[model samples]
Target: MNRRLFTAAGLALFATASLAAPALADSLDQIKASKTIRIAVDLGSPPFGMNDASMQPTGSDVESAKLLAADLGYKLDLVQVTSPNRVPFLLTGKTDLVMASFSISEERKKVIDFSEPYGVIQIIIAAPKSVTIKDLNDIVGKRVATTRGSTNDKEVTTQAPQADMVRYDDDATLITALISGQVNILASSPQTMAAINARRPQDPLEVKVVVKTNPYAIGIRKGDDALRAVVDEWVKTNLRNGKLNAIYTKYNGVGLPAEMLK
Candidate 1:
Protein backbone atom coordinates (compact mmCIF):
# COMPACT_ATOMS: atom_id res chain seq x y z
CA MET A 1 0.00 0.00 0.00
CA ASN A 2 1.08 3.54 -0.65
CA ARG A 3 2.45 5.20 2.48
CA ARG A 4 0.42 8.35 1.97
CA LEU A 5 -2.78 6.40 1.46
CA PHE A 6 -1.98 4.24 4.48
CA THR A 7 -1.45 7.35 6.60
CA ALA A 8 -4.77 8.79 5.54
CA ALA A 9 -6.54 5.57 6.38
CA GLY A 10 -4.82 5.29 9.76
CA LEU A 11 -5.75 8.85 10.67
CA ALA A 12 -9.38 8.18 9.91
CA LEU A 13 -9.35 5.33 12.44
CA PHE A 14 -7.79 7.37 15.26
CA ALA A 15 -11.01 8.09 17.11
CA THR A 16 -12.23 4.52 16.75
CA ALA A 17 -8.92 3.09 17.92
CA SER A 18 -8.76 5.39 20.93
CA LEU A 19 -12.28 4.51 22.01
CA ALA A 20 -11.74 0.76 21.67
CA ALA A 21 -8.33 0.36 23.28
CA PRO A 22 -8.06 -0.97 26.82
CA ALA A 23 -6.72 1.38 29.45
CA LEU A 24 -3.46 0.97 31.36
CA ALA A 25 -1.56 2.52 34.22
CA ASP A 26 -0.94 6.06 33.00
CA SER A 27 -1.05 8.12 36.16
CA LEU A 28 1.70 10.07 37.85
CA ASP A 29 1.72 7.50 40.66
CA GLN A 30 2.04 4.65 38.21
CA ILE A 31 4.90 6.38 36.46
CA LYS A 32 6.65 6.83 39.78
CA ALA A 33 5.96 3.24 40.75
CA SER A 34 7.46 2.00 37.49
CA LYS A 35 10.42 4.38 37.88
CA THR A 36 10.14 5.23 34.19
CA ILE A 37 8.30 7.79 32.10
CA ARG A 38 7.58 6.76 28.53
CA ILE A 39 7.62 9.81 26.32
CA ALA A 40 6.59 9.57 22.65
CA VAL A 41 8.97 11.53 20.48
CA ASP A 42 9.15 11.61 16.66
CA LEU A 43 12.69 10.60 15.82
CA GLY A 44 12.06 11.54 12.18
CA SER A 45 11.44 15.23 12.86
CA PRO A 46 14.61 17.26 12.65
CA PRO A 47 15.61 19.97 15.10
CA PHE A 48 12.91 18.60 17.35
CA GLY A 49 13.70 14.84 17.34
CA MET A 50 16.22 13.02 15.13
CA ASN A 51 19.17 10.69 15.27
CA ASP A 52 22.58 12.31 15.65
CA ALA A 53 25.83 11.40 13.83
CA SER A 54 26.20 8.25 15.92
CA MET A 55 22.58 7.20 15.23
CA GLN A 56 21.67 8.10 18.81
CA PRO A 57 18.53 10.09 19.52
CA THR A 58 19.47 13.77 19.81
CA GLY A 59 17.26 16.74 19.15
CA SER A 60 15.31 19.46 20.94
CA ASP A 61 12.41 17.21 21.85
CA VAL A 62 14.73 14.32 22.73
CA GLU A 63 16.78 16.53 25.07
CA SER A 64 13.63 18.06 26.54
CA ALA A 65 12.27 14.60 27.36
CA LYS A 66 15.55 13.71 29.02
CA LEU A 67 15.49 16.88 31.10
CA LEU A 68 11.92 16.15 32.17
CA ALA A 69 12.68 12.58 33.20
CA ALA A 70 15.85 13.62 35.05
CA ASP A 71 14.11 16.32 37.02
CA LEU A 72 11.20 14.09 37.92
CA GLY A 73 13.58 11.34 39.07
CA TYR A 74 12.47 8.65 36.65
CA LYS A 75 14.14 6.54 33.99
CA LEU A 76 13.54 7.99 30.52
CA ASP A 77 11.95 5.58 28.09
CA LEU A 78 11.67 7.25 24.70
CA VAL A 79 8.84 5.82 22.65
CA GLN A 80 9.39 6.29 18.95
CA VAL A 81 6.30 7.63 17.22
CA THR A 82 5.32 9.56 14.12
CA SER A 83 3.08 12.60 13.72
CA PRO A 84 -0.16 10.63 13.46
CA ASN A 85 0.51 8.10 16.19
CA ARG A 86 1.44 10.45 19.04
CA VAL A 87 -2.07 10.86 20.41
CA PRO A 88 -3.08 7.30 19.66
CA PHE A 89 -0.05 5.94 21.54
CA LEU A 90 -0.94 7.98 24.58
CA LEU A 91 -4.62 7.01 24.46
CA THR A 92 -3.91 3.29 24.01
CA GLY A 93 -1.46 3.09 26.95
CA LYS A 94 1.51 2.66 24.64
CA THR A 95 3.11 5.81 25.99
CA ASP A 96 2.65 7.99 29.00
CA LEU A 97 3.34 11.35 27.36
CA VAL A 98 3.89 12.81 23.89
CA MET A 99 6.56 15.44 23.22
CA ALA A 100 6.84 15.13 19.45
CA SER A 101 6.37 18.76 18.47
CA PHE A 102 2.72 18.17 19.19
CA SER A 103 0.80 21.41 18.75
CA ILE A 104 -2.10 22.37 20.97
CA SER A 105 -5.39 22.77 19.16
CA GLU A 106 -9.05 22.71 20.11
CA GLU A 107 -9.66 19.65 17.96
CA ARG A 108 -6.90 17.69 19.72
CA LYS A 109 -7.94 18.90 23.18
CA LYS A 110 -11.19 17.01 22.71
CA VAL A 111 -9.34 13.71 23.12
CA ILE A 112 -6.22 14.51 25.18
CA ASP A 113 -4.91 17.09 27.62
CA PHE A 114 -1.97 19.40 26.98
CA SER A 115 0.63 20.90 29.25
CA GLU A 116 1.40 24.60 29.25
CA PRO A 117 3.17 25.71 26.09
CA TYR A 118 6.90 25.03 26.29
CA GLY A 119 7.89 26.25 22.82
CA VAL A 120 6.47 27.74 19.64
CA ILE A 121 6.72 26.63 16.00
CA GLN A 122 5.85 28.68 12.97
CA ILE A 123 4.03 26.82 10.21
CA ILE A 124 4.85 28.31 6.85
CA ILE A 125 4.46 27.63 3.14
CA ALA A 126 7.94 27.39 1.67
CA ALA A 127 9.03 27.01 -1.94
CA PRO A 128 11.95 27.65 -4.24
CA LYS A 129 12.91 31.33 -4.34
CA SER A 130 11.98 31.61 -7.97
CA VAL A 131 8.40 30.59 -7.37
CA THR A 132 6.13 33.62 -7.06
CA ILE A 133 3.74 32.90 -4.23
CA LYS A 134 2.50 36.11 -2.74
CA ASP A 135 -0.77 34.62 -1.54
CA LEU A 136 -2.78 31.43 -1.25
CA ASN A 137 -3.86 31.62 -4.87
CA ASP A 138 -0.30 31.01 -5.97
CA ILE A 139 -0.43 27.60 -4.29
CA VAL A 140 -3.48 26.49 -6.19
CA GLY A 141 -2.86 23.47 -8.45
CA LYS A 142 0.71 23.25 -7.14
CA ARG A 143 1.89 20.18 -5.26
CA VAL A 144 2.33 21.06 -1.61
CA ALA A 145 3.93 18.39 0.52
CA THR A 146 3.60 18.14 4.30
CA THR A 147 3.85 15.57 7.05
CA ARG A 148 0.55 13.77 7.35
CA GLY A 149 -1.49 14.44 10.51
CA SER A 150 0.54 17.48 11.58
CA THR A 151 -0.55 20.99 12.50
CA ASN A 152 1.08 22.10 9.25
CA ASP A 153 -1.07 19.62 7.35
CA LYS A 154 -4.23 20.81 9.05
CA GLU A 155 -3.47 24.46 8.47
CA VAL A 156 -2.61 24.00 4.82
CA THR A 157 -5.47 21.64 4.09
CA THR A 158 -7.91 24.01 5.75
CA GLN A 159 -6.58 27.16 4.13
CA ALA A 160 -5.53 25.96 0.69
CA PRO A 161 -8.13 23.49 -0.34
CA GLN A 162 -7.37 23.92 -4.02
CA ALA A 163 -3.71 23.01 -3.82
CA ASP A 164 -2.50 19.54 -4.72
CA MET A 165 -1.83 18.07 -1.29
CA VAL A 166 0.84 15.39 -0.98
CA ARG A 167 1.19 13.88 2.48
CA TYR A 168 4.17 11.94 3.80
CA ASP A 169 4.39 9.62 6.80
CA ASP A 170 6.81 11.90 8.66
CA ASP A 171 8.80 15.13 8.44
CA ALA A 172 11.89 13.26 7.31
CA THR A 173 10.00 11.95 4.31
CA LEU A 174 8.43 15.31 3.63
CA ILE A 175 11.88 16.90 3.64
CA THR A 176 13.06 14.25 1.25
CA ALA A 177 10.14 14.96 -1.06
CA LEU A 178 11.09 18.63 -1.25
CA ILE A 179 14.80 18.00 -1.70
CA SER A 180 14.32 15.30 -4.31
CA GLY A 181 11.91 17.36 -6.44
CA GLN A 182 8.86 15.31 -5.58
CA VAL A 183 7.34 18.63 -4.58
CA ASN A 184 8.42 22.23 -5.04
CA ILE A 185 6.25 23.65 -2.24
CA LEU A 186 5.76 22.46 1.31
CA ALA A 187 3.92 23.34 4.48
CA SER A 188 6.35 23.03 7.40
CA SER A 189 8.19 24.86 10.17
CA PRO A 190 11.11 27.26 10.05
CA GLN A 191 13.30 24.65 11.68
CA THR A 192 12.32 22.15 9.00
CA MET A 193 12.94 24.73 6.30
CA ALA A 194 16.41 25.27 7.71
CA ALA A 195 17.06 21.58 7.50
CA ILE A 196 15.94 21.50 3.88
CA ASN A 197 18.07 24.51 2.97
CA ALA A 198 21.08 23.01 4.67
CA ARG A 199 20.94 20.02 2.35
CA ARG A 200 20.21 21.92 -0.87
CA PRO A 201 21.93 25.21 -0.28
CA GLN A 202 22.32 25.95 -3.97
CA ASP A 203 18.56 25.95 -4.60
CA PRO A 204 17.30 26.72 -1.14
CA LEU A 205 13.64 27.21 -0.42
CA GLU A 206 12.23 30.35 1.21
CA VAL A 207 9.10 30.97 3.19
CA LYS A 208 6.33 32.33 1.00
CA VAL A 209 3.73 32.79 3.67
CA VAL A 210 3.40 32.23 7.38
CA VAL A 211 0.50 29.86 7.93
CA LYS A 212 0.32 30.13 11.71
CA THR A 213 2.44 30.44 14.83
CA ASN A 214 1.44 27.53 17.04
CA PRO A 215 2.48 26.73 20.59
CA TYR A 216 3.56 23.09 20.94
CA ALA A 217 3.10 21.31 24.25
CA ILE A 218 3.43 17.90 25.84
CA GLY A 219 0.38 15.67 25.46
CA ILE A 220 -1.11 13.71 28.34
CA ARG A 221 -4.02 11.34 28.28
CA LYS A 222 -7.42 12.68 29.22
CA GLY A 223 -8.22 12.37 32.97
CA ASP A 224 -4.56 12.17 33.89
CA ASP A 225 -4.85 15.29 36.01
CA ALA A 226 -1.97 14.42 38.31
CA LEU A 227 0.36 13.74 35.42
CA ARG A 228 -0.82 16.88 33.64
CA ALA A 229 -0.15 19.02 36.67
CA VAL A 230 3.30 17.57 37.13
CA VAL A 231 4.13 17.97 33.44
CA ASP A 232 2.84 21.54 33.35
CA GLU A 233 4.88 22.47 36.39
CA TRP A 234 7.94 20.84 34.90
CA VAL A 235 7.51 22.99 31.79
CA LYS A 236 7.23 26.13 33.90
CA THR A 237 10.30 25.31 35.94
CA ASN A 238 12.36 24.47 32.85
CA LEU A 239 11.30 27.63 31.01
CA ARG A 240 12.18 29.78 34.00
CA ASN A 241 15.56 28.13 34.49
CA GLY A 242 16.45 28.61 30.78
CA LYS A 243 16.89 24.88 30.27
CA LEU A 244 14.11 24.55 27.72
CA ASN A 245 15.06 27.73 25.92
CA ALA A 246 18.66 26.61 25.71
CA ILE A 247 17.61 23.34 24.14
CA TYR A 248 15.32 25.00 21.60
CA THR A 249 17.97 27.51 20.59
CA LYS A 250 20.68 24.92 20.29
CA TYR A 251 18.85 23.04 17.54
CA ASN A 252 16.51 25.67 16.03
CA GLY A 253 19.08 28.47 15.84
CA VAL A 254 16.66 30.81 17.62
CA GLY A 255 15.25 31.40 21.08
CA LEU A 256 11.68 30.70 21.94
CA PRO A 257 9.09 33.45 21.96
CA ALA A 258 9.48 35.92 24.84
CA GLU A 259 5.92 35.30 26.01
CA MET A 260 6.59 31.55 26.25
CA LEU A 261 9.63 32.24 28.44
CA LYS A 262 7.33 33.95 30.92
Candidate 2:
Protein backbone atom coordinates (compact mmCIF):
# COMPACT_ATOMS: atom_id res chain seq x y z
CA MET A 1 0.00 0.00 0.00
CA ASN A 2 1.11 3.60 -0.57
CA ARG A 3 2.36 5.44 2.52
CA ARG A 4 -0.46 8.00 2.30
CA LEU A 5 -3.15 5.33 2.01
CA PHE A 6 -1.65 3.36 4.90
CA THR A 7 -1.59 6.42 7.14
CA ALA A 8 -5.22 7.24 6.26
CA ALA A 9 -6.34 3.65 7.12
CA GLY A 10 -4.47 3.74 10.43
CA LEU A 11 -6.13 7.03 11.38
CA ALA A 12 -9.57 5.65 10.53
CA LEU A 13 -8.98 2.54 12.67
CA PHE A 14 -7.79 4.60 15.62
CA ALA A 15 -10.83 6.89 15.41
CA THR A 16 -13.22 3.94 15.21
CA ALA A 17 -11.65 2.23 18.19
CA SER A 18 -11.80 5.39 20.26
CA LEU A 19 -15.46 5.94 19.37
CA ALA A 20 -16.47 2.35 20.05
CA ALA A 21 -14.80 2.11 23.43
CA PRO A 22 -17.16 2.71 26.32
CA ALA A 23 -16.49 5.81 28.42
CA LEU A 24 -15.21 4.28 31.61
CA ALA A 25 -16.07 6.04 34.82
CA ASP A 26 -13.90 5.66 37.92
CA SER A 27 -16.60 4.68 40.41
CA LEU A 28 -14.25 4.73 43.38
CA ASP A 29 -12.96 8.17 42.57
CA GLN A 30 -16.45 9.47 41.95
CA ILE A 31 -17.58 8.30 45.35
CA LYS A 32 -14.50 9.73 46.97
CA ALA A 33 -15.00 13.10 45.37
CA SER A 34 -18.67 13.21 46.20
CA LYS A 35 -17.97 12.20 49.81
CA THR A 36 -20.88 9.82 49.75
CA ILE A 37 -21.57 6.25 48.78
CA ARG A 38 -25.04 5.34 47.69
CA ILE A 39 -25.99 1.78 48.55
CA ALA A 40 -29.21 -0.01 47.74
CA VAL A 41 -30.93 -1.94 50.51
CA ASP A 42 -34.17 -3.88 50.55
CA LEU A 43 -36.16 -2.33 53.36
CA GLY A 44 -38.73 -5.09 53.21
CA SER A 45 -36.35 -7.91 54.10
CA PRO A 46 -35.92 -8.14 57.83
CA PRO A 47 -32.53 -8.98 59.41
CA PHE A 48 -30.94 -8.09 56.13
CA GLY A 49 -32.74 -4.76 55.58
CA MET A 50 -35.93 -3.43 57.07
CA ASN A 51 -37.63 -0.48 58.71
CA ASP A 52 -37.06 0.14 62.38
CA ALA A 53 -39.68 1.28 64.88
CA SER A 54 -39.04 4.83 63.70
CA MET A 55 -39.60 3.72 60.10
CA GLN A 56 -35.98 4.31 59.19
CA PRO A 57 -33.83 1.76 57.43
CA THR A 58 -32.14 -0.65 59.83
CA GLY A 59 -30.75 -4.17 59.58
CA SER A 60 -27.63 -6.19 58.96
CA ASP A 61 -27.29 -4.88 55.41
CA VAL A 62 -27.85 -1.34 56.58
CA GLU A 63 -25.22 -1.65 59.29
CA SER A 64 -22.81 -3.18 56.85
CA ALA A 65 -23.26 -0.27 54.46
CA LYS A 66 -22.68 2.13 57.30
CA LEU A 67 -19.48 0.40 58.25
CA LEU A 68 -18.26 0.43 54.67
CA ALA A 69 -18.96 4.11 54.33
CA ALA A 70 -17.26 4.89 57.63
CA ASP A 71 -14.21 2.90 56.75
CA LEU A 72 -13.95 4.50 53.33
CA GLY A 73 -14.40 8.00 54.77
CA TYR A 74 -17.64 8.70 52.95
CA LYS A 75 -21.19 9.39 53.95
CA LEU A 76 -23.71 6.64 53.34
CA ASP A 77 -26.74 7.40 51.19
CA LEU A 78 -29.02 4.41 51.30
CA VAL A 79 -31.44 3.94 48.44
CA GLN A 80 -34.40 1.80 49.36
CA VAL A 81 -34.91 -0.95 46.80
CA THR A 82 -37.05 -4.02 46.39
CA SER A 83 -35.45 -7.38 45.79
CA PRO A 84 -36.25 -7.25 42.06
CA ASN A 85 -34.85 -3.75 41.58
CA ARG A 86 -31.51 -4.07 43.36
CA VAL A 87 -29.45 -4.81 40.27
CA PRO A 88 -31.33 -2.40 38.07
CA PHE A 89 -30.60 0.45 40.45
CA LEU A 90 -26.89 -0.33 40.50
CA LEU A 91 -26.68 -0.78 36.75
CA THR A 92 -28.48 2.47 36.17
CA GLY A 93 -26.07 4.41 38.41
CA LYS A 94 -28.69 5.01 41.04
CA THR A 95 -26.53 3.31 43.64
CA ASP A 96 -22.86 2.57 44.13
CA LEU A 97 -23.40 -0.82 45.77
CA VAL A 98 -26.08 -3.30 46.72
CA MET A 99 -26.31 -5.07 50.11
CA ALA A 100 -29.88 -6.28 50.05
CA SER A 101 -29.30 -9.81 51.28
CA PHE A 102 -28.32 -10.46 47.72
CA SER A 103 -27.18 -14.05 47.39
CA ILE A 104 -24.40 -14.88 45.00
CA SER A 105 -25.81 -16.85 42.09
CA GLU A 106 -24.51 -17.90 38.72
CA GLU A 107 -27.36 -16.12 36.98
CA ARG A 108 -26.63 -12.82 38.73
CA LYS A 109 -22.88 -13.13 38.23
CA LYS A 110 -23.42 -12.85 34.50
CA VAL A 111 -24.64 -9.26 34.89
CA ILE A 112 -22.87 -7.97 38.01
CA ASP A 113 -19.84 -8.72 40.14
CA PHE A 114 -20.11 -9.87 43.74
CA SER A 115 -17.76 -9.37 46.69
CA GLU A 116 -16.83 -12.14 49.07
CA PRO A 117 -19.77 -13.42 51.04
CA TYR A 118 -20.41 -11.38 54.20
CA GLY A 119 -23.12 -13.58 55.63
CA VAL A 120 -25.01 -16.80 55.01
CA ILE A 121 -28.64 -17.71 55.46
CA GLN A 122 -30.49 -20.98 55.22
CA ILE A 123 -33.89 -21.57 53.73
CA ILE A 124 -35.50 -24.02 56.06
CA ILE A 125 -38.68 -26.03 56.16
CA ALA A 126 -40.24 -25.14 59.47
CA ALA A 127 -43.24 -26.72 61.12
CA PRO A 128 -44.90 -26.84 64.51
CA LYS A 129 -43.05 -28.99 67.02
CA SER A 130 -45.90 -31.47 66.94
CA VAL A 131 -45.32 -32.08 63.24
CA THR A 132 -42.30 -34.06 62.07
CA ILE A 133 -40.39 -33.25 58.89
CA LYS A 134 -36.90 -34.66 58.80
CA ASP A 135 -36.22 -34.03 55.14
CA LEU A 136 -37.69 -33.30 51.74
CA ASN A 137 -39.18 -36.78 51.69
CA ASP A 138 -40.99 -36.11 54.95
CA ILE A 139 -42.75 -33.14 53.37
CA VAL A 140 -44.12 -35.21 50.50
CA GLY A 141 -47.85 -34.91 50.08
CA LYS A 142 -47.95 -32.25 52.80
CA ARG A 143 -49.15 -28.68 52.30
CA VAL A 144 -46.27 -26.22 52.14
CA ALA A 145 -46.19 -22.44 51.79
CA THR A 146 -43.47 -20.23 50.36
CA THR A 147 -43.17 -16.74 48.98
CA ARG A 148 -43.67 -16.66 45.25
CA GLY A 149 -40.55 -16.38 43.10
CA SER A 150 -38.21 -16.85 46.06
CA THR A 151 -35.34 -19.32 46.31
CA ASN A 152 -37.36 -21.18 48.90
CA ASP A 153 -40.23 -21.60 46.45
CA LYS A 154 -37.89 -22.81 43.74
CA GLU A 155 -36.16 -25.25 46.08
CA VAL A 156 -39.44 -26.69 47.35
CA THR A 157 -40.83 -27.00 43.85
CA THR A 158 -37.72 -28.73 42.60
CA GLN A 159 -36.81 -30.90 45.59
CA ALA A 160 -40.22 -31.78 46.93
CA PRO A 161 -42.48 -31.80 43.91
CA GLN A 162 -44.81 -34.18 45.71
CA ALA A 163 -45.55 -31.55 48.35
CA ASP A 164 -48.65 -29.46 47.75
CA MET A 165 -47.06 -26.06 47.26
CA VAL A 166 -48.92 -22.84 47.93
CA ARG A 167 -47.34 -19.56 46.95
CA TYR A 168 -47.97 -16.26 48.70
CA ASP A 169 -47.24 -12.76 47.51
CA ASP A 170 -44.79 -11.95 50.33
CA ASP A 171 -43.04 -13.35 53.37
CA ALA A 172 -45.59 -11.96 55.76
CA THR A 173 -48.43 -13.61 53.87
CA LEU A 174 -46.58 -16.90 53.61
CA ILE A 175 -45.90 -16.90 57.34
CA THR A 176 -49.53 -16.08 57.92
CA ALA A 177 -50.65 -18.95 55.74
CA LEU A 178 -48.53 -21.31 57.79
CA ILE A 179 -49.66 -19.96 61.14
CA SER A 180 -53.29 -19.84 60.13
CA GLY A 181 -53.27 -23.55 59.34
CA GLN A 182 -53.52 -22.91 55.59
CA VAL A 183 -50.26 -24.80 55.14
CA ASN A 184 -48.66 -27.60 57.08
CA ILE A 185 -45.07 -26.53 56.51
CA LEU A 186 -43.37 -23.24 55.67
CA ALA A 187 -40.29 -22.73 53.54
CA SER A 188 -38.61 -19.46 54.39
CA SER A 189 -35.35 -17.85 55.44
CA PRO A 190 -34.15 -18.48 58.96
CA GLN A 191 -34.48 -14.74 59.64
CA THR A 192 -38.15 -14.74 58.77
CA MET A 193 -38.65 -17.92 60.75
CA ALA A 194 -37.04 -16.22 63.75
CA ALA A 195 -39.45 -13.33 63.46
CA ILE A 196 -42.35 -15.75 63.29
CA ASN A 197 -41.17 -17.55 66.38
CA ALA A 198 -40.76 -14.28 68.20
CA ARG A 199 -44.26 -13.20 67.33
CA ARG A 200 -45.87 -16.52 68.17
CA PRO A 201 -43.70 -18.13 70.77
CA GLN A 202 -46.48 -20.36 71.99
CA ASP A 203 -46.72 -22.17 68.66
CA PRO A 204 -43.09 -23.30 68.95
CA LEU A 205 -41.96 -23.94 65.38
CA GLU A 206 -38.72 -25.73 64.58
CA VAL A 207 -36.68 -25.99 61.45
CA LYS A 208 -37.28 -29.42 59.97
CA VAL A 209 -34.77 -29.28 57.16
CA VAL A 210 -32.71 -26.77 55.27
CA VAL A 211 -33.55 -26.74 51.59
CA LYS A 212 -31.14 -24.06 50.36
CA THR A 213 -28.03 -22.23 51.50
CA ASN A 214 -27.53 -18.60 50.50
CA PRO A 215 -24.35 -16.58 50.96
CA TYR A 216 -24.93 -12.85 50.97
CA ALA A 217 -22.52 -10.53 49.20
CA ILE A 218 -22.27 -6.96 47.99
CA GLY A 219 -23.19 -6.44 44.34
CA ILE A 220 -21.16 -4.07 42.21
CA ARG A 221 -21.71 -2.95 38.69
CA LYS A 222 -19.87 -5.21 36.29
CA GLY A 223 -16.34 -4.13 35.33
CA ASP A 224 -16.01 -1.71 38.23
CA ASP A 225 -12.84 -3.28 39.46
CA ALA A 226 -11.79 -0.41 41.69
CA LEU A 227 -15.05 -0.39 43.60
CA ARG A 228 -15.18 -4.17 43.75
CA ALA A 229 -11.66 -4.35 45.13
CA VAL A 230 -12.41 -1.79 47.77
CA VAL A 231 -15.56 -3.61 48.82
CA ASP A 232 -13.86 -6.99 48.91
CA GLU A 233 -11.06 -5.62 51.09
CA TRP A 234 -13.51 -3.95 53.41
CA VAL A 235 -15.50 -7.14 53.77
CA LYS A 236 -12.40 -9.17 54.47
CA THR A 237 -11.22 -6.73 57.08
CA ASN A 238 -14.58 -6.78 58.84
CA LEU A 239 -14.74 -10.54 58.75
CA ARG A 240 -11.29 -10.78 60.26
CA ASN A 241 -11.93 -8.14 62.93
CA GLY A 242 -15.27 -9.67 64.00
CA LYS A 243 -17.27 -6.62 62.95
CA LEU A 244 -19.21 -8.62 60.40
CA ASN A 245 -20.19 -11.14 63.04
CA ALA A 246 -21.31 -8.38 65.36
CA ILE A 247 -23.48 -6.85 62.66
CA TYR A 248 -24.95 -10.19 61.67
CA THR A 249 -25.73 -11.13 65.24
CA LYS A 250 -27.17 -7.70 65.94
CA TYR A 251 -29.83 -8.20 63.32
CA ASN A 252 -30.29 -11.99 63.13
CA GLY A 253 -29.80 -12.71 66.81
CA VAL A 254 -26.92 -15.10 66.07
CA GLY A 255 -23.26 -15.07 65.12
CA LEU A 256 -21.98 -15.57 61.59
CA PRO A 257 -22.34 -19.11 60.37
CA ALA A 258 -19.07 -21.04 60.05
CA GLU A 259 -19.70 -21.82 56.40
CA MET A 260 -19.84 -18.10 55.53
CA LEU A 261 -16.70 -17.04 57.38
CA LYS A 262 -14.60 -17.57 54.33
Cα lDDT for residue 228, model 2?
93
Query: How much is the lDDT of residue 148 in candidate 2?
Result: 93
Clashing residue pairs, candidate 2?
Answer: none
Candidate 2 weakest lDDT stretch, 10 residues: 1-10
lDDT of 2 by residue, 1-262 (tens): 1011011232221222111123447789899889999999998888788888999889899999999999999999999998766765676678889999888876667567899999988888988899988889998888888899887888789988998888899988877766667776788877777777777777857888978778879998777898999999999989988899999988886678765565
Badly placed stretches (over 4 Å) of model 1 are: 1-18, 21-26, 125-187, 200-209
lDDT of 1 by residue, 99-138 (tens): 9988887767767789999988998899998999998888
Per-model lDDT: 0.85, 0.79
> Which candidate achieves the best lDDT against the true structure?
1
lDDT score for residue 103 of model 1? 80
